[model samples]
Target: MKWKANTLSLRSLLCMPLTLIMLSTSITSAVIPVKTAYGEAAVDEQQVRTARSYQATLSDWKRWAADHAYALQTIQPESWSSNGGSIGQDKFSDLDILIPLLADKRIVYLGENSHGVAEFNLVKTRLIQYMHQTLGFNIVAFESGLGDAALGQGRIKKTATPDTMRRSIFGVWWTEEAKPLFEYMKETHKSESPLRLTGFDIQVQSPLFQNANWIPSIKLKDRALQAEQEVHKWRMSKDQSGFRKAKPELIKVYEELLQAVTKNENALKMDYPDEPHIVKLMKRALEDRIRVIQEFNELCIQSNLLTEQGDYSGAQSMMEWRDRAMASNLAWLVTEVYPEENIIVWGHNGHISKAQSLISTMPKSMGELMPKELQQESYVMGLFMGEGQAAENTREPIQLNPIIPGSMEDILAAVGQPYTFMDLRYRENERGNSWMFERMIASYQVQMPMPLELRRHFDGVLLIKQAKMPTYLPDTHK
Candidate 1:
């Protein structure tokens, strides 16, 4: 395949708003320069400049950590070169440090720099295993669709295969790095305490797993699903105008489906007389299916184009709506669905941060809008990369600039561990900790250059030294 470049300077791209910049576009220069998987490729250092423009080095960060006596927890590798580790002995004994910090917590929010960073996903999978085994966190909730999760969860209940588990979650997590997590989920299904799968997003993460077709009223449900499958015929669409033209008519099908669902609500309740919760779940899922089609107009492009080309208002509304819905769905999961069970949430740094409104134009994020009681029991960890490259959705890898000096990431790197986790909770008002209170470089590689205050948002952070693109699995859905 030819290297596709969007023909824009990295500098110019960074100048754009985070909302617009995150809409994945080709950023390669087309001039070929191949590099190893785990090592940094040669990219212009000037392209990595932040607003601060500080001339600093790894030595400076080390000097700062030495001054502070900064304590760091080094995480052991589960062996990156191959999945298997020293089978008998404990490879992840380092994870014991997280126990005291998380043992008493009800929820753990794992934030990645982006959806496609393989290193983040790899460690997160281990963390999930550790948390599940040690801390009694039985549920692994993704930032996927509520309805899809509902259906996926049902499938796992029936037959928990690796494919079934992978299919239940988002495609971004469908990789060789993520294969262990999928297999683990399958393995634990027959155990006494299996990891439960769920999602909180209003958006559709997996097109393959759907549940709206199984509604109580099959005739009404099939009609809507038929219209939806018809919309998939435009999957190869290159014409934006065609989608825009048909959006209204396609939306009408869902709108009618929603109306019919509401009208027959009581009758649906009658069908599941002994199981009100199941009835409620299917009803809410039907609503989710309707809302998702409208959000993207049965297309992922619609979500990305929300902010592109003078569509700022559309983008803002969609962002606020998604965060709010995610919050509500998560709250429901904790209180209603998985009551008394601890949960681990996996999502992007933007959606998982508590200080989202403080840093961005967002009114509230999923972290902020979560019920106050549930929020009290939650701890959010913002994961970051000190160096290396990330390819969003397995596209051309964009090399990250060095960690911006005086930023949170820079300060964390000050600790000088190759892969480490630092607890930012319960620190007294002090000097070395002052970095958390300042607005800093959270995602120089992902989006939002130095826009968030760490202490105000994250309770902890997992900093990996380098990031590499994931080995994306074959397009099995195709």
Candidate 2:
């Protein structure tokens, strides 16, 4: 057959091994040097073969997916209430399919592309409910302020009203989509065995972080209180310029306060015998906050010093420090607070991946760290969208581009499902192709180097054909 000038010869294509062809297709850019009559020129052989092979493989995969993809009816009836309400047995039958996969896993991570997607948050709520009711998951964690989350957990344990629980939560979680989750948690908290809520981030300005004065005045001396107030004042200013200048001072004083608290932990517990459990929990949570703040402070210091020295890798290390702190806090929560309970973690996909992305320079994420630390069964599920609008860190709208060809997104979108789920763990065997284990391409506002291997990084994927932003809670812009 005649081939186009830009295409590869059939003989040349047939000469290459399928493994090499698959590897070339997985790359972000692949160029084959053609021996032209005059000089060498790059041809799109790799891209062509990748597209063709992927198309054929995807056609077969879809046939398989049709049988495997869980139907919406299995998850919930079409007439089911979107509002926070009790789900019936029929609705749970869909989630029951996941029970075997989750049976041995202690930590289940559900990740989203953006924080503002209403549908994603709603689905997360549903899955969380199923996991709680069916799989016996008791702890729910977020990439939020640990102090604030701990305070919210306390309120829920006390059987506080929904309004109180909402107020106790950090504003980042104050979206209309998040309302049902709070409602469900509030209702569940009144049960004989209640669920727990916690966070694992370094944000210090959350309401609970600002109001961390419950640690007895005797234990926290006047000097430490004054230092904390000073840091709080700077944080409230919201002036990045001023905060950068004062950050070093803030770190110094915060470290001093942490030291004081560490020294007086025994005395504080002894002084409050009746509320020992509460006091101990609060102490541990506060210590987590301190560790996170210390990490952030070190990041800032290292970044500045590195910038001055013209070494940028320090900035990347700063990012890694934050993730490490998150991982540490998560480990602490499982080991100290709820050793016997199964925990569900919610966060952006980046933080929950088990492998490094070709695009990111940071070290392994909390998802990677946690499983290794616990040496227990853990699973990660990443969410993707074919096309839609997403919010940036600054709350600006960004239109998502179409699915990239040869990527997992394109493969799943072609399945002709509005929503679909794929268990990546067993996809390799199902597809009978090692290519299925390769990195799955994704799109980002800032270009990424390459995609991450789907099978290695994620246990499962939840794909949405179209996505839209959720309604933000009042005065909570980001």
Candidate 3:
């Protein structure tokens, strides 16, 4: 997880004149004449001519590269200003140029390098609003727990104020900058034409009906409380010798709890027949929680077994399980919840990328495991910055270093723009167009030597000249 040093040396290695070096070696070795058919030493005229021709070709190529190396000017993006919050319909005219290209796409993925970039979050909010208003995109999915985000959505549906909705979101999205997005969603939701918000991640925030306030009847509330206590005991248990013996008991408790919740859902439905929306929302949220808890329980069981067997690598399966669960949940959302609706997915670049080019050894991202039909209907957009400040895991300020030479970011920075959008699908059929073939190589937590093929990995890239850390809201745990 170290940043690469001596980039100047790496650049020199990449730009080395291989043809000239090879020609020099050939010249030194060609001095000795070959024996002719008559046993007389003679210079092979054909071989000498071929070597001279190759040398001439190499010289021509060197001159061509020197002359055309700065051809990035030919691909300059249509300039647009991203100055403030005035990114409405009138200001979108310049960006309207991309509508035709994206019109057929069903799913548009917006990605960011880090979670705490103010500019990225702002731009994404603007883009989401514009897309939803203009392109009929209805569902907006986030990389958060389904139950927690759905609970937030329900609150919004009930016209919750911005501050209340802000507190409802879990994880990194709980920031001051994200408040505007929630407020916008609340203002936009209508009984006749509602704008839906959902999450497709696998991390569960809280179990359904764990609090007494959520259950209507005292009997049901007491049942939920007893189940929660038992589940907690199982989770906090440290007696390995009795772990296997407790599995059946744990399963029985889970099943009973699920049945109790299901019974409560039916009871609420009958009691609140005039107000079915709340009941439906609670039921869906409970179902999402159940799925996540079941997955987690299975993961714990497998990890414990692996630990007993002395195979610690099996612990990593938990991540694979989470990823697979996320993908499956997204697929279910698309097929069952919002069929025939175009969706916008927002997450970190690593999670939404079509391939794990950033982390070569990691499991396939959610986009990678998507069904082929869904894949064809998707367009992945990656966001990158040249230089900026970001927050480390410890919330300490860290700087984004200058672009490395011969990298995709370096070539884009040469365009000398504050912001630009490049469609990677554009391919040029010209020689010496290394920029078109060079892949995107980036590093965050670790130094990644392998580069992602721009055309194959991402449909487009949004490049910002500089970035700054987002202003986080007060920590929820605090």
CA deviation > 4 Å runs, candidate 1: 1-91, 157-162, 206-222, 229-280, 291-311, 444-447
Query: Number of clashes in model 2?
Result: 0
lDDT of 3 by residue, 188-296 (tens): 5532334467777755444445433535666656655555455445444445446456555545544554565566766654432322244544555555545544555
Error of model 1, residue 27, in angstroms: 57
Least well predicted 10-residue stretch by lDDT in candidate 1: 1-10
TM-score of each candidate structure, all chains considered together = 0.71, 0.73, 0.70
Task: Identify the runs in model 3 with alpha carbons over 4 angstroms from their true place.
Answer: 1-88, 157-168, 190-192, 210-214, 217-257, 260-316, 357-359, 426-439, 444-450
Q: What's the lDDT for residue 436 in model 1?
A: 52
lDDT string, candidate 1, 312-352, tens digits: 65556667777887888889879987788899999988788
Model 2 residue 347 CA deviation in Å? 1.1
> Cα deviation in Å at residue 455, candidate 2?
0.8
- Model 2, 109-218: lDDT tens digits are 99976775667777887888777766678788888767556566654534434443353455545667776777677666446444567777765544433344434554
Q: Candidate 2: which stretches are off by over 4 Å?
A: 1-54, 74-86, 157-170, 207-277, 289-295, 304-312, 357-360, 371-376, 427-435, 444-449, 476-478
Question: What is candidate 3's CA lDDT for residue 444?
Answer: 29
Best by lDDT: 1
Q: Which one wins on TM-score?
A: 2
How does model 1 score by TM-score? Answer: 0.71
Candidate 1 residue 2 Cα shift, in angstroms, is: 52
> Which should have the higher TM-score, number 1 or number 2?
2
